[model samples]
Target: MNTTPASSPPAPVAALVQMTSGIDPDANLAAIDRAMGEAAAGGASMAFLPEMSLLLDRDRARSAPHIAREADSPWPAALQALAQKHGLWLHSGSIPLLADDGERRVNRSHVIAADGSIRARYDKIHMFDVTLPSGENWTESSAYAGGEALTVVETPLGKMGLSVCYDLRFPELYRAMVDRGATLIAIPAAFTVSTGEAHWHVLMRARAIETGCHIVAAAQSGTHADGRETYGHSVAVDPWGIVLADAGCGAAAGDGGYRLSFAPVASAAVDRARQAIPLARSRANRRITL
Candidate 1:
């Protein structure tokens, strides 16, 4: 008698890079190049970068100067090459793309295939516009228009959802992605140090527990050229809400530069987590609309 064989489960290594990206795209690219190499060497099959990976200009007046179109941007081309060279899926957290008006830009995320092709592109749907208790204010809508679509992509790791930094605050978005079959979610962020200190870990773990999906979050830490400081604690969480790895900055590292961290991602973990909770399936029939 002949028996059917069980298919191999998906288990891919994911690397999340934490950075202190400044105004220079070239400098950022160089840092990214080294980090990617380090990640790949550590056996990572996929790598995630922080938001505004290409340029993090604090000066609102000069933000648009580094914005580039996907096709025309040297950053994209170089990133594609890096992905191809490492044979890894590269998730650029978010890049600044020039808008038609030429005055504002779009915060876009791209997933590059191991073959150097773009698998998916996601523009950030939610913009960060808030006034903090520290008297810090941000008006993201002034320079970057919000994206209207939710982006998900098929990859060797699993079905992945793409989201920028600010999008993490909205649990509805992650629920919607789970409805669309996302097993892992990418949250590339540059969260303010103040907010990050208060809520980063809790929020990250909350999303993982709520969605029953692995969370990959890369962040920018330290002060930028524009005088804004970001909280840097890049991390990966398992579907079971366990912290797989955390790239702690500041006192932990004692330096202000770039750091790369890795964690193992397995489809079986996702399966086990969902099987235990069964929340997604239970909510499948309930449609909640705004």
Candidate 2:
């Protein structure tokens, strides 16, 4: 007879939102409100949104008016109100906010508790400064200053680590999150179609397998008003490197309209995966030659 104790508690349901946000914050907020309602109705305790959930305007001159300090931005307050109304925890993918310097902006993500209080915030550490083979060039550093520290917070879902798009390529960040006792990580992204098709799935699975943590990557999808096309495959991966759900890409996803997908996040799954492999212990004992 097989007799083994449960590793942890039962799983919680998480809702991942895939959006194609435009320049209008009001329209975007309306979409998010509807999604939050749906997420609550679907039994999701927490909802994870894609990067730039509030606004996604590439034109600096046009987006300038909308991007302001956190205190001045109405979007954050609206999101908090939505969370409170739905009685659901919210992982606001990323919002563009003017930095303290008042000249540059920061891609910031926030964790809002169920009661409408802000729990934690994380600025995207990595800037998208690459020139794609398709002749698409993005110099995020020119407008958005990179973050200096990592952020992790406690929630009903689990001890959560936060990161934004472009940060996914750096495995060291995920490793550090695991070292900090994070059982789940949220990587909100707005991936280009070309890059998403090539690396999104592999990186998502790799991060999950390496850290033994549930990975929820809410993403932006479809063509945006700014004339950029993003790959729309919002995905959730388990600690065992298994895909729990994937909101498909292209026209099937309403060309980046509102799409909500649900996934299970169980602490027991994390514990079981870590126990089976014990990578953390092995790494702890490894010699560093730097």
Candidate 3:
């Protein structure tokens, strides 16, 4: 997934941190810090860490206190400090932040400035409450409150819209995001191998095709220590629906480690060029009323 960054203005260079996170928050932060440092050294303007960046527990009870909140929270502050230290924009994937109920948490995402400021926070609107074909049931609603808002934040790159993993399946969400002027979208995820194999790439490409925006999906690859396996081919899809880079994740890839990881930094110059000549805009509009 390596590509040379042609000479241009201060374009956005986004590095993705892929992980098979264990139950420990500190360990996960340490891994993220290391990867972020590498990204900065590699000349990245912005870096995105995958979802469940803080804590991933098959058991919900043990993961509640670790849910992040506020500017001073360790995870948020840690990313802010890292961004400030490296002078880069940090898009931290959704963390479970504490909410009104002591037991329930808000699935949260944070956008931090290079100067150590919290720019925007997006709570994951779509919940992963489902029953997969493998009979793996996920009831995210029991532990989280659904966000009743569409979050699109202005970044140095462009209008970046926020949506967590499961939301990728719903094109209407991405359509609404683009209708509001989103030039780029982020779908940070911890997609299961079952669904990831079946619908991961197809759904993502469809969203990109429908929205006319670049999709940068930083992912959780490989098997988790909790016995949950994720589909780990983290990808960056162009507005034209071409996969610019697919970070590899195989069975022998470090055995739940970050081996086949890639720092696929895309250029704004090229992205703008794609948006300048979108085929979706010129086509006849079809009206579908339910």
Number of the predicted model whose lDDT against the real structure is largest = 2
TM-score of each: 0.91, 0.95, 0.86
| Tens digit per residue, CA lDDT, model 3, 28-110 | 87777777777788877677777887777877767655664454357777778878877888888878777655556787888
lDDT of 1 at 96: 87
Candidate 1 accuracy as TM-score: 0.91
> Candidate order by TM-score, highest to lowest?
2, 1, 3
Cα deviation in Å at residue 164, candidate 1? 0.9
In model 3, which regions exceed 4 Å deviation?
Answer: 1-11, 68-72, 101-103, 250-290
lDDT of 2 by residue, 1-290 (tens): 76997666557999999898888888888889989999999999999999999899999999998889988888888999999999999999999999988878999999999999999999999999999998899999999999999899998889999999899999999999988999999999999999998999999999999999999999998889889999989999999999999998743434236899999998899999999999978877889953
List clashing residue pairs in candidate 3.
none
Maximum-TM-score candidate: 2
Error of 3 at 253 (Å): 6.2
lDDT of candidate 1 at residue 205, scale 0 to 100:
98
Candidate 3 global TM-score = 0.86
Model 3 is weakest, by summed lDDT over 10 consecutive residues, at 254-263
What is the Cα root-mean-square deviation between model 3 and the actual structure?
Answer: 4.9
Q: After the best TM-score superposition of candidate 1, give how far the Cα of residue 179 lies from its true spot, in angstroms.
A: 0.8
| Per-candidate clashes, comma-separated | 0, 0, 0
